[model samples]
Target: MGDRWHIEVDRSICIGSGMCVGHAPDGFDLDSARQSHARATTADANEKLLAAAENCPVEAITLRLADSGETVFPPED
Candidate 1:
C-alpha cells in the first residue's frame, strides 16, 4: 500500500456521503453539493485513503496504480 495511486470518484453514483471525508479527510473532499472528490488525482498509498474507498457506501471511490493503471480498491474479481 506504499505505491502511488490514481484516485477517482464516480460522482454519478456518489450519494453525497461524507464517509470518505471522515475516513480520509486529506484524501477526499466534499463539494458544495456534498459529492466527494479526490483531494488529488494521484497520491502515495495510505491506509486511511484505502479505507475511505473501501468504506464508501456506493463504492464511488476508486484507486488505481499510477503507473500500471491496475485496480487497487474495489479490487478486481
Candidate 2:
C-alpha cells in the first residue's frame, strides 16, 4: 500500500465556502452545481490539500488513504 490519498466532498453538506479553494486551488473547485469537487482522484495530499480539507467550513471534505480506504481527516469516529 502506498501513501496516496483520495479527496471527496459531500455536496449535501457543502455550503459554498471557499476555504478549500483558497487553501488548495488546484486540489478542489466549485463545479456547476456549486459544490466542491476533486480536480484529480489520486492527488498528492500535500500540506495544502490537507489544509483545504481542514479549512472546509462545513467539514464536507474528506480525505482517504487510497491504498487502504482509510479516512484520515475529520477522523473516523
Candidate 3:
C-alpha cells in the first residue's frame, strides 16, 4: 500500500537496547540521554523499520498503517 505508516514505542516497556535505532536510524532515534525511550521520526513503511521493531527485545515498538486497518508484526517484513 502507498499509505503512510506510523510507529509508536512504549517507553515503559523499552529497555534502551538501541535495537530500534540501530536497525532503523531514519525511522527511530534515541534522545541525547540515550534512555530507554525512543522517538519515531518517520511515517513511511519500510523494511528497515520492520527490522527495528523486530529487533526490539521488549517488543515495545508498534507499526501501523494510517490509511488502512492492516497491521503486522515486524511490519509485514
Question: lDDT per residue, candidate 3, 1-77, as tens digits?
Answer: 56566677888777788988888877777776655443543476778878888889988887777676477654466
Candidate 1 clash pair list: none
Please identify which of the two predictions, 1 or 3, would achieve the higher lDDT against the true structure.
Answer: 1
Per-residue alpha-carbon lDDT of model 2 for 1-77, expressed as tens digits? Answer: 34788888888999888889899998888877778888888786588989998889889988998888899898877
Report lDDT (CA) for all predictions.
0.94, 0.85, 0.72
**Candidate 1 on 1-77: residue-level lDDT in tens?**
46999999999999987999999999989999998999899999989999999999999999999999999999888
Consecutive 10-residue window with the lowest summed lDDT within model 2: 1-10
Cα lDDT of model 1 overall?
0.94
The global Cα lDDT (0 to 1) of model 2 is 0.85
Clashes of each: 0, 0, 0
Off by over 4 Å in 2: none
Segments of candidate 3 deviating more than 4 angstroms = 36-42, 74-77
- Pick the TM-score winner: 1
The candidate with the higher lDDT, 1 or 2, is: 1
